[model samples]
Target chain A: MEESATQPPTAATPSATAAKLAMRHVDFHYGPFRALKDISLDIHDRAITAIIGPSGCGKSTLLRTFNRMNELIPRTRVTGDVLLDGTGIYGPDVDVAVLRKRIGMVFQRPNPFPASIYDNVAIGPRRHGRKEPDVQEIVERSLCRAALWDEVKDGLKGPALALSAGQQQLLCIARALAVEPEAILMDEPCSSLDPAATLEVEELMLELAQEYAIVIVTHNMQQAARVSSMSACMMMDPDRAGVLAEYDATSLIFTNPKDKRTEDYISGRIG
Target chain B: MRMSPRLSQNLARAVIWASAVLVIGLLLFILAFILAKGLPTLSWDFLTQNPSDMGRGGGILSTIASTLFVTLVAVVVATPFGVGTAFYLTEYTREGRMTRFIRFGAESLAAIPSIVYGLFGFIFFVITLKMGWSVLSGGLTLAVMILPTIIRTSEEAIRTVPKMYRDVGFSLGATKWQTIATTVVPSALPGIVTGIILAIGRCVAETAAVILTAGSALQLPTSLFSPARTMAVHFYIMAREGISMERAYGTAALLILLILVINVAVNLLVNRFVAKGR
Candidate 1:
């Protein structure tokens, strides 16, 4: 274990500096096929944790497990524990709706509802039963936090689908932010965007890291290094199931990975 | 004749054009023939006055009234049940034995002949249920007959709604029913309305079933229990018995005009409401 290499980034340390979420021996199966083998990691508060791997390595699957979104798929089952703030999210008593509200997610594609931009951002607050007047404020604050208020403020009544692909993605982020979640999970949010749009989203992810625990799954190693503090490398095992290979500070994971597979992956010796 | 590429191409174009012309020419000929014979009989009194001597003379006001009443009731009764069933099939349940059974049942109902539907309605609504031959009975029978049409079309419409919208709704913490109601159903409204319009068309043109269930009474229906007569049944009775050829042609022309008006109205409605659904 490269424990010494897990150095904190040179930034204002989070107020709590404790793990916001933790997974313990978690295994996920889609019907008869195992998609993710026993994996465990601690995601710290107020830090951007990036999970980098090639396609079909279960990074998105693992990210979805945090909010229990994986349970939506038919015939899928999860074993072991995924804890948020020390309480297991998969506990029988835990409300899935409340769990998702605490941990929002951004999908790879920009999926804005066919509604006005204001309604798109306001839907989260409204769905959580916020008052009509309070919803407006929440929408503005969320969009401002997402660095989208300047462009969209005047045209809030316009349809969300009319926005450019990159703006639509930012609108999706603002929608997630409207719920005021403790953590945000992104599944290769910039994978569909152009290079300039990718940079803009990366900058926003970094800005959002100051206030929320952010976890991102990306094929772009440069993006993982640019936006995240801690990073985990995942690889498909012999059985074609994803397994976590290493976890450490982003700098060390890029510079001096302890696992041979991780070194091979980062050095472009293997995919 | 020896087959050649150019000859085959010309032959294909000629066959297509000939079929198209045949269909359009038949439609136009029927329209012109009906108008030429029936227009002389049409008058203000013909539209507004009640039939005299069992439709031998005077107007078909009561039959018009009955046709409108039965069609309206059938549509009103069928829309909710049909749309609800569609939602259940598409949103609540997975495609399995039960859903397949329901779909198969709907398809069979759609394929059943109209006269067979009349017998079933007569036996079921008029006799077993003891509703008597009234507008309510006719409407209920037509509702059953059209239910399959509405459900199938509505299911198709609901299916066209993108799955991504549902994910966005669910991920926003909306409940399942809420997600379906707010996201899925609204997007599918145009398709659902189309289903209702088709049901209306079926109800308007129906004859044997309406006659059996609603009882061809030549008077305006005063209540759901009141017996009534639709134009199609009146036309069938008139033309079959050779009682009044002029009256039958006038009734046919009116029915044709009514259908054209309905199609135009529906087109306007679709443009106003559904064109902007996206």
Candidate 2:
């Protein structure tokens, strides 16, 4: 683990870009059980970073920490610095609502509100007190950005739950985009989707990475290899705490991993 | 000899079918008997005119008015408190000693007899508060009586809403209050409304509580302060005093019909909400 931590940068990759979100020696616990330990990484702006590991590796937990979402779980404690644009987010005076608005999230399941399509996208802007006219524009622009505008333009008033699973996932993406966040964190956003829908989501993620910093946690190693520029491989330590085994440019992590665990996991030999 | 599985399965099915049939048959028999005896007594005049000669010679318009007023008061007063308590239990607090204590209190309240509630109301709202035997007194009493029903039903309804909806709301940057107001409450509206309607049914059917809290006055109540008699209390008085069994049956039949209409309306509302959700 120590050797992998000090491995030199392989080439001029997206890692050279300025960090959009930086974590330093972060540890998280649920009651007495440690979930993440001594994790440090820099997620770059205008790029897709993927965290991949087997189940129970705390990949999803790590993704949720980016926006302070783990605090929603009771008895959960987080220590160390998590900085957005180089400023710590865990200060006592921070308004969590405002912080969350700046860093949106998408879940594993496409949970559209039991409301009209237009309302689902408009929820964020409305909550933030945007005027109706501006909200209308934001909803349309967000749907367009998520690549769902063409499919749902004629039925904005229809129930969001009536959409197909794939379309619903896209609607969730549109909902996150409507908040106009600087970054988006997704927790296995495509695990419940079919292959066609998965492909569409991957394409949208690539486009979204051009504008906002995106972090995705997935069990699908191919998805990580296909879309992300940078990848982090996580594995559970003996004491059942999640530790980052490897982090590098996606190409190197898949082809020439510095850690044997990363290579073994990627080669389907171990998880 | 041991019973065969097939025989036991058939016996169980037979017992379940018999129980369902017995229940439905009893209900239909009672409904048919009341409609047969009371339908002849119901006329346009019987519905529109105020009772004359102590409820033997005219309509029950005054009793209808009193029932409506009392139910309106009870529902309007109890809905906020009931729904708010439910939200506090399900959303604001985690399961702990405080929540358990509150839940125990609500459950205990629900189990007490309606007559006991009436006695409490007589002591508190009527004599102590000096509200008198008026619509206000009876309505407030019934409000206390049905509050537990509303809380329990509303709590169950709110709990049934997928936890994922709350997660989505928070992820979109909504404050706690905003998330509940916009997402949680709306999703639970149909069930909440159903609970309130059930409470209304209880208020409409209450005789002991109404008679004790609101005096049986034949005259049309002109204000919340004026003493009034609900249909159930009027029916009780007519039958107990042998004033008119026909009129009593008429009031009972009308009450049943009103409850039926309310239940049907709730079904329609729930169906519409379900369809819209899809």
TM-score of chain A of 2: 0.95
TM-score against native, each model: 0.93, 0.95
lDDT per residue for candidate 1 within B199-234, as digits (tens), equals: 888999999789899998998899998999999999
Q: What residue pairs clash in candidate 1, if any at all?
A: none
Best by TM-score: 2
**Per-model RMSD to reference:** 2.6, 2.1
lDDT of 2 by residue, A159-196 (tens): 99899999999999999999999999999999999999
- Global lDDT scores for all candidate models: 0.88, 0.91
Q: lDDT by residue for model 2 over B1-278, one digit each (tens)?
A: 99999999999999999999999999999999998888888889988999999998999999999999999999999999999999999999999999999999999999999999889989999899999999999999999999999999999999999988888888888899999998998889888998998899999999888888988999999999999999999999999999999999998888888889888988897888767656
The residue ranges of model 2 lying beyond 4 angstroms of the native Cα positions read A1-16, B2-5, B269-274
